[model samples]
Target: MEENRLPFDAVILAGGRSSRLGGVPKQDLVFHHATLLQRALAASAGAAGTVVVGPRPEFSLPGVILCREEPEFAGPAAAISAGLEALARHCTSASEYTLVLACDMPLVQDAVAVLKEALVPAKGDGVMARSGDGTLQPLAGIYRTTGLKKAAEELASRGTLNNGSVRSLLASLEVQPVTVPAGSTADVDTWDDAAALGIAAGNQDKKPGPAQPQLTWEARS
Candidate 1:
């Protein structure tokens, strides 16, 4: 790793049922002429390795290790565990930290930059992003590799990761929450959210036009 770079790998959670979007895959939604998953990969491009946990998308994912949770459609916690395992098997060099991200956030690059910049001064097992409204966005966090792996192991030992909540998985860790810029952690959970982020489903082939208006932080909340 370079002197200015942090030694880390990335785990992107891309496997959600998208029940709110009526089964439309959030990762496939087009934003600025790129799929949400593609945007997420670009955001974490600095990582030593990246593993996308979910069903493989139709588009080619060059240089990405794709895998799915054991039961498929398992919760984020399970997906995270599977990502860790994939990293262990595929990554030649283990990193000290892990970037955990959800693929639905189009502006996640902003949040990733904030978390990485804050890591040097923050003292904890990880640094999680706190949105403008003070909601903790654990999915946008950077965690110590050992800490996260241990947490996953503990959860698996208790047979709880399959349907486990992210809150439960991080309960044992000491994490510093850093406030991020407005809209940095906003994600596409519903159609309204996609609209607010200037995202449209099934429009990857269309060229991006003028930049779309983004919703205010309050409006998004």
Candidate 2:
């Protein structure tokens, strides 16, 4: 869309088979009273259009464009490349950037802004999420059009190097870190992890126990 004014496109990485989450897609799981995919979409409001990259040929998403990984089921790199290519094709502007976000991260908002701040036009690539101590988050990073094309081409020619992992591509990129805020990197992989994160975040939303009121001995006073 208007990538010129922070209008970069968005990619929702929902390609994971999610075997850890009982062999079902984690994106379809309930989170914060909504499907994980729905929450991810809501956070991508700045993107002009969104694409869901998955392996299921019959996959469907209402109001959002759907595209399967080019060499469906290859791995994360394949999914990322396919999503970027799809975004490029759909976008009229040839120079716009694309933000790649994983579907399982329910607390990764403000990522786009962090990326925008770290983007150095002279550097050719934008920013990516890094942990508080600076660990790159490739799946939740901003990718410039040129960088994305290069990454895709490399992936194609190398037959998906680094075991077809997005981490490999991210490591090779000229990346900058968007230091994650405290408690913002919670990703729901195993059901256990989901439960833990849910409990933590849910607890944060509630007020702490107040001072215990004095018990009244008088009956029905």
Candidate 3:
């Protein structure tokens, strides 16, 4: 690892149903000439190892370990567990920290940078991103490997890993929140969100439609 960089692994959650986006996979959505998933991969390019947790995409992804949650689309918590297991199984050495990211956020690179910088001086279990609007974004956080494993184990012990909320997985961790730039934590959950972020559906073939009325960012549910 570079002297200025910390050794870490990355787990990207890409298994959402996209129910609000007419079943279009958000990972396939394009922004700035790259799919959302590709953008996420680029954001975590510095990690020693990366595991993408979700249904395997049709296209090839070089140098990435791909896996799915036990029940498939179970939830972020379950997906995270599977990613951690994949990392342990495939990587020769474990990193001290893990980056957990949601692929739907196109501008996550900014958040990652902020979290990583904050982590250097942080004494907590990890550092989470707080959006400019003050919303805590756990999915954009970097966490201590041991802390994540412990939390996953505790959730599994209670039989709640599957379909469990990300909040539950981080409930026991001591995380410092660092504010990120505006729109850094914005995620594409709906067509309106895609428009707000200037993303286009990758599978669409229609010509560009009339300009969409501007919409404000919606809080993640």
Candidate 4:
């Protein structure tokens, strides 16, 4: 609740098929002392409201609006659309932005603060973290609710949301891409990736703190 920070809502996309991970839901995958979804919810606790778009899991957190995409397991874009709809139900005028996140990213919390802070100066539809290898981590960003709603509606109209690419949804928006340090955008798409992050095999002692300021975009060109 910093004076300079704009109020926002949060949408955690947790409805993935996890085809490569033996059909286990990634959100339920645990790391440290919490599940991936729990970590995401904790990181976004500062938001005015939070909507988790996926099946309601046995593990619950207070104040989280749990929902699922229509047709279930549609795709990321469809999940986003579902999340936006849930967000609309609870958002107030004070909510200016929506933080979009994927549940598989265990280390995403470190990127949240910086993305929200950068969104102000960005003056764009949203601000996403760019990996050190130059990949856009769209799910790990904050977006203007108006812009996101418009995009979601347009995608639904075109009947492409169910299987559409997120890049397509963002193509029309003016986005700020801020580069982040290595591992900040690392996600568990497979057991190998999870093990690498010290999550799959239970190595919680390796958890790192937020990326150093020197490794953030603010310190780079």
What candidate 1 gets wrong by more than 4 Å, as runs, is: 1-5, 202-221
Model 2 lDDT at residue 146: 75
Question: Which pairs clash in model 1?
Answer: none
Worst window of 10 by summed lDDT in candidate 2: 212-221
- Let me know the TM-score candidate 4 reaches against the reference structure: 0.87
TM-scores of the candidates in the order shown:
0.89, 0.78, 0.89, 0.87
Per-residue lDDT of model 3, residues 45-118, tens digit only: 78888888876654556668888888987999999999999899888987999999999998998888878788
- For 1-221, candidate 1 gives per-residue lDDT tens digits of 24146688999999999999999888888887767877788888778878888776766555678888889887999998899898888778779899999999999999889888899887879899999899999999999989988999999999998999888889999999999989999998999898888875545553322332221211000
lDDT of 4 by residue, 130-172 (tens): 9888899998988888898899889889888888877878878
For model 1, the local distance difference test gives: 0.83
**On residues 1-221, what C-alpha lDDT tens digit does candidate 2 reach at each position?**
23466567788888787877667677666555555666676667667767778643222344466677755567777777777667667756644677788888877776655566666442647777877866667788777767777876876797764247886666556766678675465688887888776633333222212321222211110
Please give the lDDT score for candidate 4.
0.77
Query: Residue 137 of candidate 2: its Cα lDDT?
Result: 71
For model 2, the superposed segments whose C-alpha errors exceed 4 Å read: 1-4, 55-63, 120-124, 161-163, 199-221
Q: Lowest lDDT 10-mer window, candidate 3?
A: 212-221
Error of 4 at 81 (Å): 0.8
lDDT of 2: 0.65
